[model samples]
Target: MKRRRGSGLSETQLGYLMVMPALLLVILITIWPVMLSFHNSLFDYRLNDPTRSEKITSSNILMESYADNHYYLEGAIDNAASSTENEEAAAEVEQFAEQYNSYHEELMSFDGVEETFTTVEEMLAGFENINDNELEYVEVDNEFAEEYKAFLEDSAESLGTYVEEGNEDGLENLQSYVNSSANSILESNFVGFENYIDYFQDSRMWASMSNTMIFTVASVFFELVIGLMVALLINRSFKGRGLVRASVLIPWAIPTAVSAMMWSYLYDGQSGIIAHYFEQLGFISDTSQLLSTGGGAMFSIIFADVWKTTPYMALLLLAGLQTIPSDMYEAAQVDGANRWQQFLKVTLPLLKSAILVALLFRTLDAFRVFDLIYVLTGGGPANSTESISVYAYKVLFAQQNFGEGSTLSVIVFLTIALLSVLFIKLIGSDLFDSRTPRK
Candidate 1:
């Protein structure tokens, strides 16, 4: 008997196939980036250095550099030899070329590298861009690569001084030409695990991590407290409850950047209402001290973040609140439970999942806090307020150190992952089980 095309598949298999697209999308978008970042963290990748701009794990020869520089070097040597016209100078040029040729031959001896090298040279001579990366670059043995690089650098320097002494005044440019020739054949920039080691040794990195933790803990704690109060207040059936609920969300609805800028103005030491009030209220000894002192700046950051994001916490908790049946509260009321007792016995026990969700989100959000601290404190007062995200941004973009920045990024990802696991474990499997739909 002929079977239908899909008859062999089970219902579970069909369900898996149906969801595979979304799972693949998540892996492609989220997991792939993190894996790329992890890969980048292995080497000393930098953007400013032409040779190291890309992530190269293996020993690679920079053929374009060798080709262009060798061409110039050969021409410069000939020009210096001819212009000098002295037997001793000619002998010197011969000696320099002999040593360079020796190393050059060894480099070319690698199978197929000679062909690529010649092609690159021809393209360079024609003023054509070396579009084919493989042609412009080739693999070399790690040991040979290092030896060749060191040899070129030494020869470029020594030949510069030697040729300058024996050449004519008109040939002064030959020395510079020879010296710069070494730049064409760049060495392997791969420094495996060095970036991580350096970051571990770095005090600034640890300090930034510390600051991130402080901000996350402080902001999340305050937000949870204030948000819970707001959630409870709005959860009640009072007059104009709709208006109150809408008003409560105003702070969270504003864009983060706009909120940060607004707080920046409000935190201004001079002629700012919030700062002026804080000074009068004795929160600070002086108004001008808010942004100037390290502790004060950290305080200002937490205050700003809490104010800007607490409404979001309230909103999450409110969703959780709505899920709990009113009968739970009514049962506690019938048992002669007070509002506080009812909340502790019925609300909190049931709201554990909601709390976990809110804390996980807010904690991660606070851990990665950038724009708020960036706009407010600018990680100032001697970088005392510098969060890990800000530090990563400074290293990745400001310093153009992609390898180290990627390491920092991986650290942030791992930290968030660890926190997520912690939250899930503490909340237990029941939290998720409770979220499942009824059959």
Candidate 2:
């Protein structure tokens, strides 16, 4: 006997099973990045900072710092012993110096630590930066690490006391050396929510966010209007219509960075062909004003974006228009409906799903605008065109401020999520709701 397919699973159940792989893939690509950024944002992680180069949750020793400080510290302690004139003071200084050396050697005696320490020392002497974590950092027993770190702190206090008793040139330097050594045992760097709190006070972050919203709203609105018109015009039969459709996609075909660069030269104030025409047409005071002023630069960017993406919007709308049955238009016309009435009554209602989908894509894409603006303007003429994505890029990669930059990245993700939710709830509800069977 042949076995029944899908066993007892209904169509809905099979549908869910069919889509599981896609859902898993989406989560991996989308949610994983946000979670990673959130993890980094929790700590004071920065590539520029040796102590905070990674997301850490426990106390650890930076062997590199320890080695460097100990080298200077050993000299400072000897200098202290030699500089003291009084016999009693010199004996006390010598005793402390011996204690410090003993502790330093004991720390090195930890399993495998001595070898790592030697390698680090040799590398340091060569002025090499220890990029390998195994060579630079070590996790030790908390109790042992704390005690050793405390001993270093106490050494610093003792040196300060020596300084107070007599103005010794070497005592101050020794105290600083002990303090630096103490810092080699780094405390846990898990600073929760501090990064999120910091963004509230970040003025430039807010400016970039505002710029993103403006860019999204303006670019999408115009793309919709212009794209709708192009789709309607192209939907009708005409000579060389296929050729026109192919040619219309050329602007969108260009890579975003290349298009932005192409437009940059075209928007040049004094010599740009586009800028010259706009100036000659009396649209501006001068050709140079296209990229020199805040408003003009923003306008220039928006104009370029519209030129590059209008074809995309048209393509999406055209697909939707084709799905529309011509019979409905004929019926509307038979009922004495004019061209305008037929569009308003039959066309728009049927095209709502397409409109919603197109808006969703374009809005998110425009909100995350970076390469276009980055190449064309580099967020300048004083950063007037900087989007949150571009700002995040500068912070994370340019400044190497990973902690603060991760927070910025999380903000962008959250903002995009909010926009997606809004679109789904307000515009896409009808489109998606129809999938459910009626009671």
Candidate 3:
């Protein structure tokens, strides 16, 4: 007999209803912000603006803003000015006179003089007497024309010399002029990309990147090696093994920031226990300071990370170790395999999947490392500990350059995504498959 149809929701509809909450959450938390960031990346964004609106939205405006702020405006301005010929020079003179008259009117307004001076018009009519007969000239109220002329002459001479030598000094100077002019046009608006560019081009970026990589690789590698050894030792039945296992997990269970702070105190040269011990052991000449240098600061951070993380690695591997059957080791021993051979042939091969999972999690965590470095060195000693995240934070919030800061963030995100994909392809995907089946 055919069954009667129930309330009639299809499987697809039920599935959609089940996932509705998660889908809504993904849009709210991830998709919306990503779309907003991409939209903001297209414009010139300044963080200091409470509104977060782009004053300049077009690519032309964005490029112009960047060029103006970073002194990259010479090529365009020079090209435009050079395209004019002798025929346009007379027209340009009249235009310049009109602009000067407008400026003079504004200046007079500032002084409470509402009426335009007829004498000023008469003086302007005698433009022939003006040096070079160029309308670019303007009469100053209380300024030395000779000094201005000398200044222009010196600037021109320097620019010529720079061009002859193929130096970019002239270009930089021209770009500065453009920047000042553009800023004036924009009513002295704060364009924050200047500081962002400075931070990006600074040596601090490279120093931080290098320090982070070294700390991450060294700490993770050593943690894996040492954690494995500890796991193996603790896996065996022994007196006080439960206490030893709990003690090892204590470091891992402690908050990372708190542990870093504790280590910082220990590394303190004046009153730190570790520093005093090192001095007594003759490892250093004195305990005046331990983290003053770049090397010392990096070592301190790495040591703290390894100390806190190794127990976690050991625990993860130990879970896998417990899953291995005792018969494998017995058979290896029966086949006359030594301890080293048994480890290489039986333990390591059996632990491949667990090791890969541990490494994957640790490596990804290491890549975006910021807090430990922040607490330990505060990206100090000339920013030797400045990770990309910290640098991006300073640019976005401190220097208030949202556009460039977003650019750096996008770069870091891409780097992490690529690394994660590579890790999965290399090891994560095949981790379980690599394990040998038990007989």
Candidate 4:
């Protein structure tokens, strides 16, 4: 009988199937957002206001409506005041006529000036004849008369001036005023790319790039060194080795945001234990604020990064360490090789693949570091800690300059791609060669 083919899978197919879900998730979460961000960078997007919206257009209309209402209401109030003054003047004239009539009758009834009537006595008698209501009426009339005289004088002067000028330029002046107002309104409607250009040309970009490079290179280098040492030490048999390894991983297990926040407190100038201890040891001045200075801030960020990531580097190296054979070390020792010589010749040569892999992973991660620096310093003290990631974020989110933000992001992406390609060409292929099986 012919044997049936079983449902057995090849190692490569099995491995691919196992990673497919993770690969799909990576594309969905990381790659998709990056692609979306790139697309948005092409557009000049404003988050605060929707583009081409009816509400924005309506705002202009509402402003115009208010301006029109203000002008018309002011004109109406002035015209009403003028009409009231004219009515008051007409009433005053009528009152004057009534007073003149009464005076004339009194004068006619009296004998001639020689008929024993003194001027002072006649004035006092006329005042007494005026009733309280009539006196109040006369007082109000006089106030209006004074105000009307001033108004007429001012109006006459203005009218005379206008007549002398012949009002020849009034239409041209009005048209020019309207044209300027229209230009201002149009200017408000159109936005410019000056901010984008300024952001690209500024020294802030280069400064941030330099600081970021230093941070990434230094932190990755030291973290690798220390992590390799720790991994090597723990790779050997020891009591409670599992507990020690687990303890070391605690730093890495803590979230980056939480770790950064914890470090910020530890670096606090006033009451921080680290600061106080360092000061007591004379490592730094007592008055020193770690985050206040550029160098100190850089150091603080690097320290935080190493503290959080060293365990991760060690874990990677430890995985590689487990693959190495103990026979190689035993053989090297039988050849009269000391520990240092054995490490240099046997251990280091074997650990090259692990070191390169760890370096590559850590370097890329460090290059894109933002959380630690952001939480600790917020790119403060004159943007001393402003990485390319932070700069891109500020342009895209804070300034809402998506176009320029995209430009910066493209630059960063290109740089990372070039570095990755170069690194792979130099050492990555050999380091990850699967054809050569380890002993």
lDDT of each: 0.83, 0.88, 0.64, 0.65
Instruction: Give candidate 2 regions above 4 Å deviation.
Output: 1-17, 64-68, 80-183, 435-439
Candidate 4, residue 135: how far the Cα is off, in Å: 69
Tens-place lDDT per residue, model 3, 199-292, is: 4586766666676677778988999999999999999999999999999999989987889899989989888998899889987666754688
For candidate 1, the 10 contiguous residues with the lowest summed lDDT are 162-171
Per-residue CA lDDT of model 4 for 1-439, tens digit only, reads 4333354666666778899999999999978876865655444545543331111211121122222332343343334334433454334334433543453244334334212223323434455432332221111122333343343334334323433444423322322332222221111122244444665687988888888899999999999999999999899999999999999999999999999999888888986787788778887776256888888888889989999999999999999999889999899999999999988998888888888889999888899888888898999789988998898889767877665676678667767877788888887878666686668
Better of 2 and 4 by lDDT: 2
| Candidate that scores best on lDDT | 2
Q: Give lDDT tens digits, candidate 1, residues 1-439.
A: 5333466876777778999999999999999999998888887899987768887766777677767767777888788778776676567677878877888888889999888988887788789998787887788887877776676666556545644566364245555655555555556666778888898899999999999999999999999999999999899899999999999889888988898889888878887889999999998999888889999999988998888899999999999999999998888899999989998999998898899889888888899899888878789989999999999999888999899999999988998899888877876456677566679
Q: Who is ahead in TM-score, 1 or 2?
A: 1
lDDT for model 4, please: 0.65
Per-prediction tally of clashes = 1, 2, 0, 0
Better of 1 and 4 by TM-score: 1
**Superposition TM-score, candidate 1 onto the true structure:** 0.86
Residue pairs in collision within model 1: 65-184
Best by TM-score: 1
**Higher lDDT: candidate 1 or 2?**
2
- The parts of candidate 4 lying over 4 Å away from their true place are 1-32, 49-200, 432-439
lDDT of 2 by residue, 329-387 (tens): 99999999999998899988898889999999999999989999999999988988899
The runs of at least 3 residues in candidate 3 whose Cα sits more than 4 Å from the true structure, single-residue gaps closed, are 1-35, 49-203, 432-439
* TM-score between candidate 2 and the true structure: 0.80
Ranking by TM-score: 1, 2, 3, 4
